[model samples]
Structure formats: C-alpha cells, structure tokens
Target: MTGSGIHLPMQSIEAQHLAELVEQFLELLRDTEIGEDAALNRLTPVVYPEDADASAEFADATSADLLDRRAADARVVQAGLVALGEGPDAPQQELSLAGSEVDPWLRTLASLRLVIASRLGIEADPSPDPDDPRLGVYEWLGYRLDLLVDAADELDGV
Candidate 1:
C-alpha cells in the first residue's frame, strides 16, 4: 500500500464515515452563501490582506468563478465517494484509487480538512491541546490529507 497509488483496506464503518464526510463537505460547498460562512471564508481567503479595497475588489471579481469551480469539483468527489460506499455488505474490502482519481480526491480531502481546521481554530501550533475533541478530529484530518498528498506526489514523480 506504499506506492504511487492508494490501496486502503477499510471496514464498512470506515467507508460509511468517509461517505458521510464527503456528503457533509459537498453540502457545505453547494449550500453556503459566499462571504457569509466563516468556514468558506477560511477556505477562500482574501487575496490582499493589507488592502481592504483591493481584497474586496478581487473577491467580488473572482468569487463566483472560484466557487463555481469548487462546487463542480465537489460534485465529482461526491460521486467518487458514493461509488466507494456501494459495497456495504463486505465486512472488509480494499479500495484502490488510481493516480487519475487521486487529484480530485486529494483536493476534496484538503478542502474538508481546511473547513474542519477553520471551525476548530487550528493554527500553526503543532501540539494542540488534546482536551478539545475538535482539535483531535482536525489533527486526524490533517494526517489523512498528508497521506493522500504524499501518494499523489509520488504518482506525479515529485
């Protein structure tokens, strides 16, 4: 399972959890109004932090296009997740995703992690207090994201 591809052996519960995560992410992508959601704001940050006018102008000009692209990508990832979740009867199964599938999967995972991190107020601190449950979830998402990224990079010969 250590190569340029993903070969994950997951239980039915794991697949269900992944599907739920992707569904939630897709809802956030499709339902949230731009500029109103804190998580979306974090996902799509201002281009020019020092200049309010410039940042606003940039956002106004590009937000629609950017959101459109994200929503489209989310749809693709949703379909993939749904397909992965089909075989619930199997107690144990190995799900394999090729390099072609990895790109969008990586993006979706990263976006989900970003939303979770934003909600959890995760920052540069590597050692967040374990007392907060959200922090633990955020850290786990980061770890998963990193694994996907590494696999994608290996596939791309990076």
Candidate 2:
C-alpha cells in the first residue's frame, strides 16, 4: 500500500517521519518569533496542502487545503500513537506550543501522529481545535507561494 509517487509504504506508516516532521515544524515555530507569520506561511504547504492552491485545473487546491491536510495528517498520527499504545489510557506527555506559529502547527502534527498510528493498526482520537487563534494568514504561506510561483514561472520563462 505504498502512496502513489511517494516512496513510503502507504499501509506501513512511519511514526518516525511524523515525529520528525513535528520536530521540524517546532523548529520553524522557534525560528519565527511571535508577531511574525513568515515561518508558518513558508511551511504551510508541507504542513497543509489545501491552502497551497486553488482555482486551477486537475490536482489544484485552495487555501482550505491546509486545513484538509491537517485533518488527514492527524489520522496518520492517530495510527502511530495507537501503535505505540500512547492514547487516552496512556500517560500524557508535555508538549510546548508557545510562540507565534506553534498551536496550529502542533495540532496538524498531532493529526499526523494519529494518522500514522492508525496505519499501524492502532486507535487514536484527534479532535480539531476551532478556537486556535493562529489561523491568520501567515507570511509562511506567502513564502511558499512565492517559491512555487517562482518555480512555475521559471519553467514558463524557459
């Protein structure tokens, strides 16, 4: 059950990858100080693809794609956590979600963890937080858009 065009096995989810992604996202949060939105915007695509693009033909996405991906990723995270037996019945670990771009990122990462745990034959529950205040348009998304447009433009320029 390998993901299409993706190297990892779709059915054999990897918790490590999910964890690493979370770690990287946390780093981005740390790098982007409070009041700055650059970090989250840049990593938006990787964290959530729905907000990457929209209104385009085939395979196109909209800004909401980010939220969609977050939910999907959360499913993966649940799979992983369940696999590890780290769930409601298990001990809760401390996770810091401070800084300008931390809460949303953490939520997305948590979702991914559940997804991974599920793929590994485990049960996990990841509830979406609608009250998160960091849902604003961050510079990070613009940064990624800049790179994507630049790449597309470069190819077109060719």
Best by lDDT: 1
Error of 1 at 59 (Å): 0.8
Off by over 4 Å in 1: 1-5, 124-129
Give model 1's TM-score versus the native structure. Answer: 0.80
Q: Which stretches of candidate 2 lie over 4 Å from their true place?
A: 2-36, 45-61, 86-158
TM-score of each: 0.80, 0.25
> What lDDT does candidate 1 reach at residue 78?
67
Shift in Å, residue 82, candidate 1: 1.8
Worst 10 residues of 1 by lDDT: 1-10
Whole-model Cα lDDT per candidate? 0.72, 0.37
